[model samples]
Target: MTQHRKRDKNLGLAELVAIALGGMVGGGIFTILGISVSMIGNLTPIAIIIGGLIASLAAYSYVKLGLYYKDEGATYSFFKRTYPKSHFSAAAIGWFIIFGYISTLALYAYTFSSYAISSTEFANDIQIRKMIAIGVIGIFTLINVLSVKGMGKIEDLMVYTKLVILTIIAVVLIQHGSTSFEGFIGDMAMDAKNSSTLSILIVASITFVAYEGFQLVINAVSEMTNPDKNIPRAIYSAIGLAVLIYVVISMGALFAIPSEDIIKNKEFALAAGAGDVLGKMGTDLVILGAILATSSAISGTVFGSSRQMSVVAKDGYLPKWLAIRKKNIPINSIVGMGVMAAILILIGGLELILEFGSITFLLVSLLMAIANYKLRDKTNSSKVLTTFSILGLAIGGVLILYYEFTAKWEQMLAIVVLYAVLALGAWIYSKKNERAKKIT
Candidate 1:
């Protein structure tokens, strides 16, 4: 009985929400804000809200499918099980989703390092920033490998504490802002008139990456209690909260800082701007919030994505060694993810990593939406919403691609090449799995 109790659910609603929020809020807003403001000016908040709504549509399908499948593998497992005969579908999604998580992991670690040294003399040193980013990944990888419950508790602490810091930073910035509410509204009107619809929509589509972490809750289905109730609860709640947090913080930044300054110091805009308004103290607060935000995100991503990686490896879609687990924890997968993310950071620029992650997740989520739409009856999902999800995600995917093609064809070519490689690897694994099955 004691053993049974010990083996029972280890995560609750709060922890689940934290994991989702941790994943969602991690470097997303910090990384996207300057770009969004650069593209749409004061209209960035509107784009962010639209992005959140699109994310909600994506979440509807994820929540429905999660409850129905209840697989800790979440995205990859759902597709694999839903279409049991399609080895390629399973293998492809497994590869894409794991690499998508790897990209975000690198994004978070890079963002963490960016803010960690934003105020220091080393702020301009790219090499030092990359080293710090890799170091932070190593720290969180160790934390995740140590114990699941400990990771959960640490996540809860970091996520909630960061929320408080972020909220305070928002309020403080708003209070000391140069632009009044009326002036801010005027600027929004002016920017809305000047910005093209496609540009605004493109910004909205780009902001979807910021909303990517809510699905991490679904990946924790095994560890959480009453997943049927908590899955939707934690996911929806986190996304909603994320949308609110992002909007508030963006509004505060717009009010306090000039758009050009934000665009100029895109990497650490908040810290750069806060120093002028809130002085050194305000900058410190912003840096602290960013560090905590990205830290929890790294922890949650490592926790959830490693589990999915293990699940995929166990099914022979990835290297077999990644399947090894110690005490139900995917220790090897966690370490492998850290190493891969570090290598990505070493080789890929920030923009490349960010765009790759956004494109991969959007494509994968679009596929998941289609799967849920097809399995609507079993998942008890709304066909109308599922269809909407499919359309919305499809549109988002296309918009990002269009943006890429028009703005940076070279990056688009690189992304295409990467996809080709991933597809080839997936095909090889699927073929191997088929032959083994036939032999058996």
Candidate 2:
């Protein structure tokens, strides 16, 4: 068989940033902010800002690695190329990258389903909610299969939508406050029941989920117009903008809902916050924004992960059949990802998927950090930041993982599944490497 090679032309800066922002600011932030406020009181915004900074540092590292290598594997290729010392580590990073993509596809699939069903009482009448969710995945999957341009346009528009909604709410809360939600932070002075050091850290770890989506840009690097310059600029700009918006929205959410009500009703925290003063219209818009944000997230994830699948296919890790062309794109794997995402949606537990996805990203990020330092190439700016960012991310990851895993035994199973994927990828890569050596 002839060697197959076809690459997506570069996408513009707007498309790149849209992808990053759309992927990062999903439904979790709206919901997670509520949960964070309830637990940390007035410091909910502070906790979110902390998580945002940690996530941004990780984003900065990804930007650097993506620029340095400019390869399709994104973080996977970065680690594998940078550190040849341990093949196991390379495989681990690859597996984790794949896991993060798939898990996000799953996480946001659930979000879309919830929103689609909430539009109609009958939609949730049966187990139909899950079915609806799967249906939404199928549609987006088809879109991706058709063309990459369409997906990029859709993602970019969604990014603007999310920014507008969040911005409006922030303005409302910041300027004219009709309702005094001061009690939301009444516990700010370290009340023993809620202010335990353990609880705050636990909340930060949970908040991390709200902040980890910007790396989606690298997955589309092949389609990006200027990988060397655009990738770095777009990725960093997206992270900076998202961090600012998230902190403001988190603070607004804290001010809108009483801490007690926020804890009691985590479902529509942002809407409630909006409702406190602005009444029904404000709450409704926020809910609508949440729906749009989550939908865009699911769309971006399916689009990006499927592209990664195409990249792995080009590299010969996945079957060459996936690398074959249909309308100048990878149709088979894109549809396959859609099907996988739909199934994951049927699994129907957002919390489980979010934690699993976040942990998976952290694992890959930890590897990238180690790879940067081990490479010891300080002359390169990307590597330099990767070194420091990866280290900071690891400390944060460890703290959060310990806090999260200690409580949920189910998480151990996620880790097990995670490692299993790593082992499998490593074995496959070794086989391929051997075949290549023999051919030479």
Model 2: lDDT to the true structure: 0.68
- CA lDDT, every prediction? 0.92, 0.68
Could you list the CA RMSD of all candidates, in the order they appear? 2.2, 3.7
- Model 1 backbone overlap count: 0
Worst 10 residues of 2 by lDDT: 1-10
For candidate 2, give the lDDT of residue 407. 71
Clash count of each predicted structure: 0, 6
| Number of colliding residue pairs in model 2 | 6
| Residue range 193-219, candidate 1, lDDT tens digits | 999998988998998889888888977
Question: What stretches of model 1 exceed 4 Å from their correct place?
Answer: 1-6
If scored against the real structure, what TM-score would every candidate get? Answer: 0.98, 0.86
